[model samples]
Target chain A: MPMHSPTDTPLFGSWPRAYAVVLGALLLEIAFFYGLMHWFA
Target chain B: MSSLDWWILGGTIALLVLYGLYKSRGKQSFDDYTLAGQSLPWYHVGMSVMATQASAITFLSAPGQGFSDGMRFVQFYFGLPLAMVVLSITFVPIFHRLRVYTAYEFLENRFDGRVRSLTAGLFLLQRALSTGVSIYAPSIILSTILGWNIYWTNLIMGGIVLFYSVSGGTKAISYTHLTQMLIVTVAMFIAGFLTVHKLPTDMGFTDALRVAGKAGRLNLIDTTFDVKSRYNLWSGLIGGFFLQLSYFGTDQSQVGRYLTGETIKQSRIGLLMNGLLKVPMQFLILLVGVLVFVFYQFHESPVFFNKQEVERLNAGPLAGEFQVLNRQHQGLSAQRRAAVLNLQRATAQNNDAAAAAAGDQLDKADEALAKTHAAVSDLVKRNNPAADKNDVNYVFLRFILDYLPHGLIGLLIAMIFISSMGSIAAAYSSLASTTVVDIYRRVWPGSTHNEVVVSRWSTIGWGIFCVVVAQFTNRIGSSLIETVNILGSLFYGVILGIFCVAFYVRSIGGRATFWAAVVAEAVVFVCYYFDLMAFLWFNVVGCLLVVALAWLFTTLQLNLRPVRVADE
Candidate 1:
């Protein structure tokens, strides 16, 4: 087995934070689009 | 086509091809040819990943979907961001650490060669078939615009892409993709702006959007939970997630794109970029269609978008009936235009009762217009029994040709062709890479000396096979985008299932997974044949079936052949 680094920073502070931001953005988008749909309709 | 239009289209494609080849020029190595030496920057990887996923059909047919069916289709991509996060966290680091050429190579590492070969075989089959659809999409543009035989256009389209793909390999494909995506985004944005610009002068963008919304073309989200409904929030999150996960993780076409990143971080960022952007990109494309739908309200829209079918109907015995239907369609269009204007004014004035009346009138006019359209479709079918009744695919293209200025028309057409080439090149690159790395290299382990040559030949061979498959694309009716996705849903699930077990269920051995995949695939086919549910669910069902069956099979195998306690 080869040693690999685990502490590399992504967009956010850490990998888990980055994943959370992505999921958070998705939730925000869904909520926004859902509101936009009813607003326009 | 005008001489200027021809010049614009030809110049753009030639420039892209030459530039890609120039940028890709380097010393040959097997790994470099297949994976771009694993040195592409995140931006290049991200753009390449987007280009590989957004084929010409996405540009051509997605707007038509929006125009006819509304923006509910955008929900289909809602799962993509979640899938990207999953892929970034799980798939990227593992594939990077393993230093595998193909995603299937990891299957062998985790299980054995049989599992590897089976997964690779499935990827090849599905990718080859879908690549054929991608090839056929641009061929439709050429055949429709130039009045040429689809067969010749298919060959020309495939052959051109193959030349660049073979010459520059993955690096060339990625380089061209950067330019392709830039052009696609700018051109599509222009198309949307022009669509609203061409609407009635009294109506601005918001008014047009309101008009589309009132007509049900702005259905961006649906909270309903119906298994049979293909595009809603629930199905999109669950079904679309599985589909995107399988597509990005297991399908070599997409895996090859992200795999070219210089490091695991680059790959993860590239995928995350795609996740963040794909939904908005699809939303804007479909929004263009909605705007087009509104544009037609203020203009004399055609009863049928496919001019070839209309021309055939005109030349046939039903020409008289067609003339009568044409007059009825014109009357309905005029009435609908008036009703739309009335509704617009009523809504603007906040006259709820009057607006309701106008809305009712507009709906009736639309129903009448749809009836006339249906009659034309029937006439088309009567003229040629095999003719596709769904003209949704031609909706946007017809608008561009008939209404847009000559140079912009050519640019938009070129944009479609460029997008198509980017995806087809990537598909060919991945197919050839898998063939050489997984199949050929495995069969003849000592032939690594000539690996580059073999991969190049594999590219040519698969290109030919895909072109041949393109010939049958016409018979598959309805929206070209939906048809391609449906074809994917049938196979993607089982492939994803096998990988899910490989990644998560550590105890499921190779034999169990192989047989589980085989059985799950058969059940999916049966379900599809029987119309068990909407196509998107097939992805979820197929994946879950495989995982469950793998566990069952593993437990059974364990019980049947008990582990012998050696020296106890």
Candidate 2:
């Protein structure tokens, strides 16, 4: 396997993209949990 | 009753041992032994990380937690995924780029040698003791179910893990973890299905949920911010976040898992996958417990879950009082079961008035049952002073043995043993690595000769140390899960503080941070001893204290630095 250089930027470079991915994940978690609580409550 | 279970158990052990030895074949180098030559792909890293976290306690106790306290424990992992994201962004890339063997190694380069050694020492102490408890946790279940001596069970459990860990090292541990996790996931899912299946034919999965909810076992969230409450949403998100961060980012055992990733991206992805999956995984496990609780409601449960202790109580002077409690327990259990069935029926028919009436009756019956349980536990303690009086830990285990078929029973029991081995093996490997790399090499400078030999001996020594710790673990109550967390909270904050200073605080050199850590740790100990707050909050308090104290000492050092330089 080829190792990425330490200085090489990852594919998801922009700060906005990073923030969007994190935010989307958080929202997904909340929605999934909400559904679980609803169904199992 | 059948030969299948013995064959399955023997075959599982044989396959695991041979696979471990096969994967372990490599050069006799310390790095290869400790890190699998740092060549594992993302899947191996992911499975290894999950297996290490999902100890036997998780399978054995989590459902019991759900049965006793409800699903609120699932909240504890809410912060885990977020912690993984933070670590991926900050900790992962840095550790990968630096190419450090242990997380503490980075502390030395960023700060000073003392800081590195201090953090490593804390990891050794906490992980070693926690691993022993992990070994002891499953041994209790196995010993209880199979009627074997607990002491021998501990030795066998610890010895099995040590065999593969010593022989094959990290590669063997990871490969076994991958297989172990696959088996565990399937077994646990089957266990959950069986728990619901054992309920009355009319009581479907939804009905079980209604009964569980009515009994308050489906409690998944609490918005309350009370520091004393252990598993509320506030603590799970905030306090759990800090704990998970310190654990994955700073703790060497977990760091060692990701460090083996062939590339930084693989490590990050593996960690991120854990963060995403952990909460749901915990929720599913806890949900199984809720189902077990429902199963007991419709069926007869023991007056006391731990049969041995109950048996001793029956044979002792407390026999009369225990008999009365047992009768009361049976009456209350019958009433509660009827109420639970009625509530399920009412809910299904959408009869609000009937459901409400059944719910009230169920609550009253549950209160009587709880009192009976307490009385029985008191009798057990009065009879045998050494008895683990908490029956909550034994709830799910009792259900498994009494209800599940013989073959499945053996597999689930073996699953617990396998889970224990995966974690104990990883911990043993990590303990050895830190001792060899951080303390031994540092103290005996220029002793590169026989480094692999030294590492092997260190693994053996730490394995024996952990087994010894396991021997005395029974004296510490049945709250193995809580005990491990409390122990970690005692030291993680100070360790995290040292790393935080190393990373962000440029002015705070080794001496100031070291002394600050000592002081912060003392304060944390005092807080715990005095019972100022819940144990989970200790993680937050300890980490903040280190950061605050380190800044204070750094300012003092800076002021003295100018005067001392002028004098010189």
lDDT of 1 by residue, B109-219 (tens): 787888889989988998899999999999988888888887899999999999988898788889888988998899998888888888878889888877777788878
Tens digit of per-residue lDDT, candidate 2, span B1-568: 2477667766777778888888887665777887778889888998899999899999888888888888888878877877888787778888888888889887777666777788898899999999989989888886786777788989988888888788877888898999999999999999999887888888788778778777888777777789998888788888888888899988878999999998877787788678767877888999998898888887788998887787778787888888888888888999998898788778889899999899999989998888888877777777877777787778878887888888887788778878788888888888888888899878998885687777778888988999999998877876678888888888887887787776666666677777788889999899999999988888888888988887887676644121111111
Highest lDDT against the true fold, candidate: 1
TM-score of 1: 0.96
- Count backbone overlaps in model 2: 0
- lDDT, model 2: 0.81
Off by over 4 Å in 1: A1-7, B558-568
TM-score of chain B of each: 0.97, 0.96
**What is the fraction of true interface contacts found in candidate 2?**
0.17
Interface RMSD of every candidate? Answer: 2.6, 4.7
Deviation from native of the Cα of residue B10 in model 2, angstroms:
2.6
How high is the CA lDDT of each candidate model? 0.88, 0.81
